[model samples]
Target: MTTTERTAASYFLPSDEPLGLVFPDGAAADAPALPMPADDVLLRLYRGMVSGRRFDTQATALTKQGRLAVYPSARGQEACEIGAILALRPQDWLFPTYRDSMAVVARGVDPVEVLTLLRGDWHCGYDPYGANVAPQCTPLATNTLHAVGFAHAARAKGEDTVSLALLGDGATSEGDTHEALNFAAVWKAPVVFLVQNNGYAISVPLSKQTAAPSLAYKGVGYGMPSMLVDGNDAAVVHAAVEQAVARAAAGEGPTLIEAVTYRIESHTNADDATRYRERAEVEEWLERDPIARLKRYLTDHGLLTEQVQQEIDARAEDEASALRERMNVDTVLDPAELFEHVYAEPTAALRDQASELAAELEERA
Candidate 1:
């Protein structure tokens, strides 16, 4: 077997020691295999991180006000979201989980469109082909298969396309995740699996999810390399993902990246985080906030001034306001619209439901 096809026989855990490119103490700790980003790129990443946080905050507030049915806030995991998507080229595709709307936005999809599925309106808010982004999958790890298939097809067509599949730590436990990895490795598909290990899969802690040394280690069994990085450090996460993309593009198969981060909020608007985790744990993660950490690095190096910081914050605020304005408008639901995308032709069961719902609406009228 070639080196790329050599499966690791022993089960091992990912290194508990996380890789960090930039530290919270305002220093670049260690660079990854990929070269560090330029200062300007770093600033852009910081701005993106700030914008993602603002979007999450506003979306969470909207859920509370009944403007949205549900929101899985990525409040503390913005770095992982930004880094994974930012590393991809325009030709690359992204498959994100429902909680990773920020990644969809960062990939240049309309912010409002990214929220479409969560708004309870459509299958996806934007055109998947138009944006090269798959729907924000609500079911755990199912999108992994989609990503692998897309990447494999691209390779067969002699196209240099890589697919980045972003999933929550909880998703790592799903059976589809294993199937996707196994297939990708065997086929040498140009895909990257990014597991944002936010310490919990909803109410269940990582310890209860699996006994594997780390989610990253699961890649080794599939004959792929695995990386561990501090997900709160944007530069580190970005570099790690960038390297993985490069490897995939070179026909080096797949890489599994486990980003060590924390979820600072409840699983969703309807979840009570207090029931499962201690407030102290959340507070500790707050100190390592992605935005704050990146801001500190920029300021310490004289790359950002107070004026620049204010400007970035102002831009984020304006974007948030626009998103709120768009979401606040009431949606006009046509009872018939529900049956439109069920299939090419509606199934017998779906046709019956559509008729029943139409009759019920007509009676109210």
Candidate 2:
């Protein structure tokens, strides 16, 4: 109602099965066909998925080795993580959740800096404004409103900038998510919300998260357009995200996308998935693996050649090796650094507290 209205039908997805370009078996879907991406784009998507899965394994290994404090593996959710990044423009801002470490890395942030927070660092590793990506927010749904504010500011300044908020299904139920969606629609801010519905809010399943038909349907109440897409299909994820990004840039307010994905790994290194779920369930989702599905489709189309595969694998390995090497090295710690960023100008009381802490650390040293 703010502006840029669209046909009511366009706001709702035609099918409930989740719009998909490729089937689980690598076959293209029939009826109301979704267009496949260009060959090069598909290849790039494939490469990103492959490398992302490899990175997940490497990160998991780091956790076992005690190098990383913990890692939320995006092993099965690579499509959503990588596709969302590719859909974004360089000048656009991204507000990501902690689980979106992989997505942040895809946005060209340094891999090392991406893990600095998970490594138990005090401050967020990279500069949010500098990288154009907010810190990998650990608090649930807190950053969604930040995205809305940023997008609204950009629109007020008449800048052609958009904000993309990437969160999970669990976040849909938070008060901040509700406020963010409503305010964004009312302000007609150019922002896109990509909710990766990975079936669980920790150990709780989606059935407990919301009784709504689907997470995307949450958009209706906010007067935002929404889409439900198969998150395991990289092509569809990228295509859908691109469409949403286009709408935002066109001043169409916001779009809510509930990507139907699965959390292939447990909640984190600390959680034992088998405690609540069956191993067979995990095995079943494995067959629909995003990387394998995309690889099959590209190979059949003659897009992924043997040499290309080898080169991509080699590069991924090199990156993993470098990451492993760097993470293994112990970093020098400065106890006094914790006082930074609290205030532009330090309060006397705060200065005294910091001085006391510095003195304590000096004595310990």
Candidate 3:
């Protein structure tokens, strides 16, 4: 084949329709070789999703009780939250956004520690180095660059590592997203970018965010392969992310996945989603709930017994109860620690400011 033909054949295009293994009604799609994971793996994904949603509910309650400063709930996006992380191996890195606390917990980070940032206690609750997960990024799309850089470094060291960076639809408009995609494509970095298109970026709808047909279409501009998946379908998202990860592990560069999901709740406790969208719209997305859909599919296939359901629900409740109790306790924090990791070496001006802040706290005490 000619060089041009070879290049043309290499480019993997985004799906004409979002790839989905199950319908919104929870019926598994008709297929010969379905991309569904093994039954045990499916049960694990289902359990993670159930726990994630449980955590989301508890965190939202904390926000109302004024324990957490703020929380971006991934209520309706449980499939995306759990499934994507399930695709990763122990060594693969995860770079999550502020809205992806559920995904962080699904990655095995402590549920309480996962809320550390929202608790107004520390920058990050869990140690990033302890696992391959990075701090939950609040800035739009910046973590994509970090993921790309880390993937490049891993490749440089001749290690088989892949990084998955999660972001919202609104972040795709940011320059950092563009830079990360371009850089990853050029360098063949082992990374996967999962854009959770939850219909809105805070109050801004996707209609106002970008003119592209779908965020996955942006991959074409960067010469990167892309896939579009039903983010609410755990099996579909898990299968697609696994495919992308396997491709990246083979040194084939990055893949952009746009998971079409919805944000059932308001952007945050502070923002009113009613200002920009209608209640009917929210009601519609709630019917397509990821957790319920998976539960139905598993039950139909006889994979989910009543005993299994009760066991998963019990475990989830335990986590929520623990989160509620822990959040109720007061946290003692040291203001001086804010300057601890601000720089490799504390600058003279930074030290002076830190000292002044310390003295001010001491005087107040």
Error of 3 at 37 (Å): 1.2
> Could you give me the TM-score of model 2 versus the true structure?
0.95
The lDDT, on a scale of 0 to 1, for candidate 2 is 0.86
TM-scores of the models, in the order given: 0.94, 0.95, 0.96
Alpha-carbon runs more than 4 Å astray in model 1:
1-16, 32-34
Number of clashing residue pairs in every model? 1, 0, 0
Q: Candidate 2 lDDT, tens digit per residue, 264-307?
A: 88899999888888889889889899888988888888888999
Name the top TM-score candidate: 3
Please write out the lDDT profile of model 3 over residues 108-173, one tens digit for every residue.
Answer: 888889898998888888999887889999999999999999999999999999999999999998
User: What local lDDT score does residue 30 receive in model 1, on the 0 to 100 scale?
Assistant: 66
Candidate 2: minimum summed lDDT over ten consecutive residues — where? 1-10
Clashing pairs in 2: none
User: Distance from true position, residue 43, model 3, in Å?
Assistant: 0.9
Candidate 2, 311: how far from true, in Å? 0.7
- lDDT string for model 1 (210-234, tens) is 8987788888788788888889999
In angstroms, the error of model 2 at 101 is 1.1
